[model samples]
Target chain A: MITRTLFAGFGGQGVLLMGYVLSHGAMHKGLNVTYFPAYGAEMRGGTANCTVTLSEEKIASPVASNPDILVAMNFPSLLKFEPTVVKQGLVVLNSSLIEESPSRTDIDLLQVPTVELAREVGSERAGNMGHGGSSQGQGKVLRTQP
Target chain B: MPSEKMLMRGSNVVGEAAVRAGCRYYFGYPITPQNELPEYLSARMLDVGGTFIQGESEVASINMVLGASAAGGRVMTSSSSPGISLKQEGISYMAGMELPAVIINMMRGGPGLGNISASAADYYQATRGGGHGDYRTPVLAPAGCQELAELTFVAFDMADKYRSPVMLLGDGLMGQVMEPVIFPDFIDLKDLPKKDWILNGCEGREPRAIFSMLLGQGELYHHNLDLQKKYDQITAEEQRWETKNTDDADIIVVAYGTAARIAESAMNDLRAEGLAIGLFRPITLWPFPSTAFRELAQNGRKVAVFELCLGQMVEDVVLSVGERAEIYFYGVPGGVIPTPAEVADFLRSVAKGDGEVGRRIDV
Candidate 1:
């Protein structure tokens, strides 16, 4: 089975780093993988995103139009990519930053108040990590939120 | 010998591969999407006892490569779209002189300051002898990080074998993607064929001149005829391509570089659905693997040429297949890359065209 994920957020939100880490782990695991990041001015305080695809077979085309998982770190990213997720796929969002609920009804929505949770844990900038960890754990996004 | 696996970007791996291929000199200017190539070689070439120079411009850089090649030094240069345009004059001169050099074009969106995004728009420029005059250069397109490294070694060899420039054609995506690659043992330059024609201070013999300009009557014409003969030989011997389940298929899709990778996935998807689809990826863009296309056409196969540009390689496919096979084309120009699912769906829609005539040709 192939797993495609789209990680989107503002430029400074560690969006591309998350993709790199995921692809690095996939490569070490001997899985065929591809990580494509948006380049140029978009990486400087603008909307940025990356596509990461891991599969047992050789991956074709690094651009995923409908990813199985969507990691939206900001409201813009969520609004921009919400409609493109696969049916019954997972949408992991930082609830603290985005107040508008996703309009899609077919997919599973996981809301983590990552900023609020990061602040409570005293790091304040760990929202990206928090959301990433939540995206990996499919069923615990809501169950583990204390 | 076991090689050490290292994780690196495609651009850096290509640079390292050039060094391992016995490339002792590099000249290039900085350009986005491919800046890492020159940057990596700039610091590492000296470590390998090679020379690296960041030229003021692409023209100057390609000329430096020409000079290095004329001296019989294994040399390379790299640039992006606009930079490659600037190097065309130098490339024509190098071809005229019959010098050996490796040029890497990590193409970005083009047609004048286009954008810093991945694109295969330079297909025509790379394969059709972008430089002026009548000359042809062998070109290779690598699909992944490992292929990028592997083709760098092959590019150097092909250049030296033919006494002409060879191009390693890729896009920004191939340059930026990071993956694990294992480096093999460096080729021993001493063991390879020596450059007997190098003008290394011709002593104890008659004086030899290396000239790109021949103004005498029939001088350039005869030189061009010899070059044409050499090109014909290369076309016969150096055509490289890959086929997946093409032995028995109704629809054969022809693509190259990243587009080929995507087309492969699409073919797999369609195959699972009982569609008779196969993929043909050209590793050597020039020489074009036309023989493979001719064989497929002789076996009565239909073709669909998919590209990231506006149908460049499709022309070659049509010429090779001729009226014996029907041809179709789908292309997304500039930096927009079509998804595998999208391509698969498109292939599915046309999978049942058993008796349809050629869409691209009037016959």
Candidate 2:
């Protein structure tokens, strides 16, 4: 099975780094992996994201249109990418910033207080770590903790 | 076994490789997905008795590179999509003067004012002369960090050998990701060919005049023809590509750089599913591996071209096939990267005669 994940947020929010870490972990596990980053002006602000694909076989297009997993670090990111997640896939949101819940019910949703978790970790940058483990209550949404 | 393989990001690898390649001058403005390149070079160049200039803008940086190259020093410049657009004029000038220089374009999305997303949209601009010109710049598209170093070294050699500008065409992922890279030992600059055409003080031998202008039509035509001849030579001899699972395969996937690496993953997946799919990745974008593709297509084998853009490289794939076999296109646009399973599904559909032509998804 191929698992495609998209991590998106602001420029300095470590969204891209989260994708990199997942790609590294996938590679370490001997799975085929590809990490593609966004380039150009969108990097300045608005939104930034990277696609990470891990699979049992060689990957074809590194661009993910409907990601199996979507991890949005901010409100705008969640709003922008919430529509792109595959049906019955998984969505992990930072509850501190994203006050509204996803409208979709077909997919699994995990709302974590990532900002609070980061504060506990002594850095807001650690919010991405909130996506590190299996989802709470919802078995579909896996949130891997640091 | 040697256990010292450092897990370094792609940008640092490119920077280190440039320094090892004897690139004494670097000028660049920062951009996303590739800032690590300039940052790493900033310190490394100082240690190697070289100079790195974080120019105020991409335009200024490329012009600085052109100036340094004209002075007979090994110089380089790097930027992403939008920044690359600004350096086209300088690239054209570099080509016109037959200056040997290396430029890196870590590609991103684009049409006009695009974002920082990985896209093969720059294929036309990079391969077909972005700057106003009747000249061509040899472009090397590296898929990973290893190629980041290997191609960087080769780019400098090719630039000096052809007396033309060379580009290391990569994407954001290849520029920012961390991976193991074996750095080559430094080479003695004196051992390399002396730049007789450079405009540095011509103290002894008859003063050499370096100019892109020609006084007469005959002279201009001759110069253009000369450049064409050199390009033709490169096309014939300097082409490079990698083929996987092509032996007795019914389908071949053609891609380059990061796309090619992704294709590799897809090919393996499809192969395990009892499907005969192979991968053909071009390391050199310009002087593209048309010959190999043509040879593969001649046997009535099905070929599929995969790219991050809206079917730019597919044109070349079709041209290479020459209607000998079916050539399909899988285009992933707007910063969307297709997964291996997605590719496998597409290949399966094609093998089963259920494939659709020009199918695109906006993920």
Top candidate when judged by lDDT against the true structure:
1
**What are the candidates' individual DockQ scores?**
0.54, 0.24
A55-80 per-residue lDDT for model 1 (tens digits): 87777777786889999999999999
Question: Relative to the unseen true structure, what is the C-alpha lDDT of residue B56 in candidate 2, on a scale of 0 to 100?
Answer: 92
Count steric clashes of candidate 1. Answer: 0
Estimate every model's Cα lDDT from 0 to 1: 0.85, 0.79
Please give the lDDT score at residue B29 for candidate 1.
94
Model 1 clashing residue pairs (backbone): none
Which portions of model 2 miss their true places by more than 4 Å? A1-146, B1-4, B31-33, B355-363
- In terms of TM-score, the best-performing candidate is 1
lDDT of 1: 0.85
> Which stretches in model 1 have alpha-carbon errors above 4 Å?
A117-122, A139-146, B203-206, B298-300, B352-363
Please provide, for model 1 over B1-363, each residue's C-alpha lDDT reduced to its tens digit, 9 standing for 90 to 100: 425776678899999999888998999999998989999998998798899999999999999999888888999999999999999999999999999999999888878998888888998888889999999989999998889989998999899999999999999888987767887678887876788888788688777788889999999899999999999999999999988889778989899988888888888878888888989899998989988778876566778888887778888887787888877777777787788887776576557554232235444
